[model samples]
Target: MPPERDQSTNPTGRQKSCARCVKSKRRCDLTQPSCLRCTRQHFTCSYPSRPAFNAIPVAEDNSPMPDSSIDNVASPFDMSLIQGHRNTSVQSRQDTCLLDLDVNAGLESIGILHDLRNTSPMPENQQTIIRSIRVPQAGECRWELTPSSYARISYAIDRMKQAPATMVLENQTPWSHPLLYEDCMPRVLQEAHATCALYLARNETNSAFFARHVIDRVKELTSSPPPTAPLDILARAHALILYQAINAFSGDLQLNAHVCPTFPHLEESIYALYASLQSSETPPSPTLISLYPATTARQAWRAFILRESSQRTLLILCQFMILLHLLQGRSYCFDHACVTSKITTSAHLWNAGSTIEFASAWNEKRHFLVADLDFSEVLEGAGPEDIDVFGRMILVTILGRDDMLGWFAERGGVF
Candidate 1:
C-alpha cells in the first residue's frame, strides 16, 4: 500500500490537538483526552477546546499579579485575529526554544537563584511574618510559640542589637509570673561577681583568660556570627545550657584554681584551703552572691595570707588555713601532728572549745599596730618568723578561745 495513509491527518480539518500537534501547527481532531496525532506520536494529549472562563476581570492597575493568571487573559472573542498570530508565534518559539536551549543552562540558573536566595539575609519584615508562625514545643518536629514568648524573643533580639552581649534564656519558676531575672540564668550574676572579685584581687591575666574562653563560648552559643544580635529560640536555649555548665563547675576549688588563676589572692586562698584540709575535711560550701566580709580588711588579709605581698608563703598559707577554718562552721583539734616533710604537716579537724576559751586566748595574743600594715615587713624573714607567729596564734586561739564566735559574727563569717 502507498505507505499506509497517515490516518492521523483528518480528511478535512481537526478540532482537538495535543502538544505535538500544537508544536507542528496541525489541526487536532479535538478529541476528549488524546488526539490521534498525539496518540500516534506516543504522547499523552488533551485539549481545552472551550476556553476557560474568568469570573473576575483582571484590574489594569499596577498591583502585584494574583495567583491565577490563566483566568485573566483577554477573551479570544474580542481579539481572535491577534490571538491567532500570538498563538502561532508562541507555539513556534516554544518548539525552537525547547529544542535549542541547553537544558543544563536552566538548571544552572535555578541553582544560582537558590544559592543567592539562601545566602541572602531575610528581610526584617519577612522575618517578622515567618516568626509569627508558631512551632510546636515538644514532638516530632513541630514548632509553636506563645505570644508572650514571641514578644520576649523580639525584645531580646533588639537588646542584642543595641548591645551585643550573649543572649540567655531563663525559665523562671512556675509559681512566679513576671520573670524578674532578665536573663534566667543566675550564673551570669555569679560570673560577673567572680570577675569583679578577680579584678579586685588583681589577677589581670587570669581574669582576661576566663573572660575570653567563657565569654567566647557564650557568644558562640548566643550569636551565629560572633557579633550578630541575640539569637533565635533554639540558640538562646543552647546558650542557657552553657550557663548551666558554668554554674555547676565554676566554684569547684581545684577547677577554679587550675583553670582561672587570675587573682593571685583568690587562687592562693583556694590553694591554701586545699593544702590545709585533712583527708576527711569537707570542701568549702558552695559560694553564693551574698557571701561576705566585703571590706578592705578582708582584702588586705587575703593579700597577706596569699603571700603575694610579704612573708614566707608557706607560713602565710598555714595561718590562712587555721583562720579560715575557724571562720567556717565547726573546727579542728590537733591531737597529734605528722610531719610528712620539713614543710608539710597533717592536722586533725575537731571541735573542742567554748566562746570563753577562745576569747581568753585572743585577748592575750592580740597585737594591733596602729600603723598601716605593711606586708613587705612580714615577708622579710618569711619562713620561721611567719610560721612561728601564725602557728602560735592559731594554737593558742583554738586551744583557749571564747571570743572567736564574736569575731566571726561581727564580720559575717565565711561559712
Candidate 2:
C-alpha cells in the first residue's frame, strides 16, 4: 500500500499543484511564480482557483460521518481524488489543458493571428475572423529559370543597384506615383528612399557609417509601433520593401542577417493592409472614375490610387520574396497561385498625371485585369505598350525574359 502524503508543509492545510503539473501527472514542488516541473519544461505555470468549500452543497446531516464510512472515502490529497476533481471541474467549465498552454507563444508562431488582432476594427456587420493570408506555393506552376532568363535577371539586379541614383534625381519608378509631389509623400517613405540613396552612394570612406545607419534605420522602422491608418500602413510596407530589396540583394552577409528578422514585420504589415482593404469600402472602379465630375473624379482617383497601390505593393513583395528565395537556393515561399488580386496592366492608366488624364487613359487604353498570375489573356489581348514597367517586371519574373521577348516580337515591339 502507498504511504499517506503529509500536508503539514502546506500551512493553509491545502495542497494543490499547478494546472500544467496536474494535467501532465507530474509531481509539483508547489513553488511560487512557477513550479520546478513547469519551469524545467518551459510550460506556463497557472494554478486553478481553489473551489469555495462554503459554496459547495453540504450534506443535510451536520454530524460527522462514522469511521467505517470515512475509511471508504479517499483523502483530499490522494492522486485519484485530485484526478477525479480535475476531470469534473474541466467538464463543468468546458475547458481543457490546451487552453492552459502558452497562448502567446502559439500566437507568435502563427503571424496572421497577431496581425488580425492589430488590424483596424471592422464594422460590426463586417467583423469576421481572418485565419491566414495564403502564401504562394511552388507546385502550382513551373517557376524554373532558363540560363538566358537568369542572365536577364542578373541585369535587372544591376539596374536595381543603380535605382537609388534615379531616385536621387527625383525620377519616378514603377512603384512611385508620377503625380505625387515631394511634400505630399509620407515622411517614412522619404526616409527610406534617402537611406537607400545614401547606402548605394557609400564609398570606401563612408561605407561603414552608411552600413550602420542603414541597419539602425531598418531596425527602428520595423520595431516602431505599427501604423493604424491604411495609407500609413501602406507607406510603412513600401519603406520596408525598399530596405529589404537593398539588404537581400546587396551581397552583404552582415546586412542580410540584420534584415532577415524584419521580414515578419513586413509580412504582418502586408496582412494588416490587406485586411484594411477588405474591410473598408471598395474603391471606385476605373470605368466609374471616368463618369464622376472632375472634383469627384479626383477624389475617386485618389481612392483608386490607394487601393491599387496596396495591391501592387503586395504583388511586388510576393514577387521579391520568391526571387530572394530562388537566389538563396531555397524553396519558393509563394507560388503563382497565391497572386489572386487583380492588377492594372495599362501603363497610361497607372501613370496618369491628373484626374482628367486618368479618365482619358481609362477610356482610350485597352487595359487588362490580370489575376492569379495568369497572363494568357494579357498576352493575347494587350500589346507591349499596354503593359506597364511593374506589369512587365512581374511577367518577366514569372514567364522569363525569353517568353516576354517572344511576346514583344509578336507585337512588333522591341524588348
Candidate 3:
C-alpha cells in the first residue's frame, strides 16, 4: 500500500459554517458543516439550508453530534425563545402563532388544507373545515325573476329586522308583563302600519319600512283587487291597517277606535288596539319614528301587536310564534311583511334592549311549547291540494300533525 493515506488527512472537506450560519444566511462552506463559528455560537450545524417549501426545515437540532462537546442545540423555529418585538404573552402566543402560520404558509398550504378538508376520512366535526364553493349557473334559482317575487322577497327581508315587544318594555316602570306589553302595543302597531304605508308609497322621506318595490305590489293590488280571493282582502286589510297604525304612531290619531276597526273579524281587536294607543299619556311622536327605526320583522310585528292588541298577552304569543318561525327559517317572509308593514317608522313603539329581552324570553318559551304541542292533533281535515307546499310545511311543523308533517317532509314544498 503506497503510504496508506493518513486517515486524518481525509479529503471530503469539513462543514465550513455551522447549521445556524447556513440557515440565517443562505451560505455554505467546505469545513465540517457545523463549523467553528456555529460551534462557538452554539447552533446545530445543518446542510442544504434552503429546503423546498413543504420539505420540513432540517431537523438537525435533534441529531446527536459526533463531538458531545457543544451544548444541546434548539430549533430556531421555537417561538417561545423568539426575540421578536411583538409583546406576546403566553395567552396570546398560541392564537398569534396560528394566525401567523396561516398567513406565512402561503396559498399552497391553503389548497392542501382545502383538499384535505374535502377528502377527510374523519367525521363531520373534524371535517367542518370543508367549504362549499358556490358556482352559480344561470336560470338555476327556485323563484321566478318576476317583479312581484322581487317585491315579496325584498318586503320579506325588510320585515325580518323588526324589534320585539318585551324589548320595547324593559325600561318601563313596575315591569308587569301584561301592563308593559299592553301600554306599548298600540304605539308599536301604529308604528308598524306607518312603516308599511311609507314603504308602500315609495317615500324615502317617510322611512324605508317596506321595500320600495313593495309599492309596486301595492299599486297592483289596489289597482286590481283580487275579487275571487278572501286572502287578497286580508292582504289589503293588513296593508291598510298597517298604514293606519303607522299614522297613529306618528301622532296622526285620526284613526280612533271608531275608525273602520281594520277587517271585519278584527274590529274589536283593532278598537282595543286603538284604545290602548290613545291611552298613552305621552303618546308616541313622529320624532320618535325618526329616532328608532323599525327595520325588522320581529320589531315590526311586536310594535304593531303591542300597540294594536288590547290583549297584550296575545301580542307576546304572536311575538313568540313569529320568532320561532324566523329561527326555523319557515314563514319568515310572511311574518316579516306583517311586522314591517306595521312598525318601520315607529320609534315610540319599541326600544332596542327591551325588544331583545322579550325576544329572549319568548325564545325560551317557544322551544318548550313546540315540544309540548301534540303533533298528532294538527289540521286533520285539510285536503292535500288545499295547502301550498310552503303553507303545508309550516302548518304541519307548527301544528304537530305527524301525518301532515311526514307527508310534507317527504314531499317537500313543491308543485
The candidate, 1 or 2, that scores higher on lDDT is 2
lDDT of 2 by residue, 128-206 (tens): 3322322223211111233443544553454455555555665455655544433376777788889877876778798
State which candidate has the highest TM-score.
Answer: 2
List where candidate 1 sits over 4 angstroms from the true fold. Answer: 1-316, 338-415
lDDT string, candidate 3, 284-352, tens digits: 422222122424434534443334322322222233233222221112111111111121111122222
So what's the TM-score on candidate 3? 0.19
Clashes of each: 28, 3, 45
Which runs in model 3 stand beyond 4 Å of their true positions? 1-194, 202-381, 388-406, 409-415
What is the C-alpha lDDT profile of model 1 across 152-237, one tens digit per residue? Answer: 22221222222112222222111111122324524433444343344234354575565455555444443443212111221232
Structural RMSD, model 1: 34.0
**How much is 323 displaced in model 1, in angstroms?**
2.4
Top candidate when judged by lDDT against the true structure: 2
Quote model 2's TM-score: 0.61
Q: What's the C-alpha lDDT at position 109 in model 3?
A: 18
Model 1: lDDT to the true structure? 0.27
How would the candidate models be sorted by lDDT, starting from the highest?
2, 3, 1
Q: How close to the true structure is residue 155 of candidate 1, measured as C-alpha lDDT?
A: 25
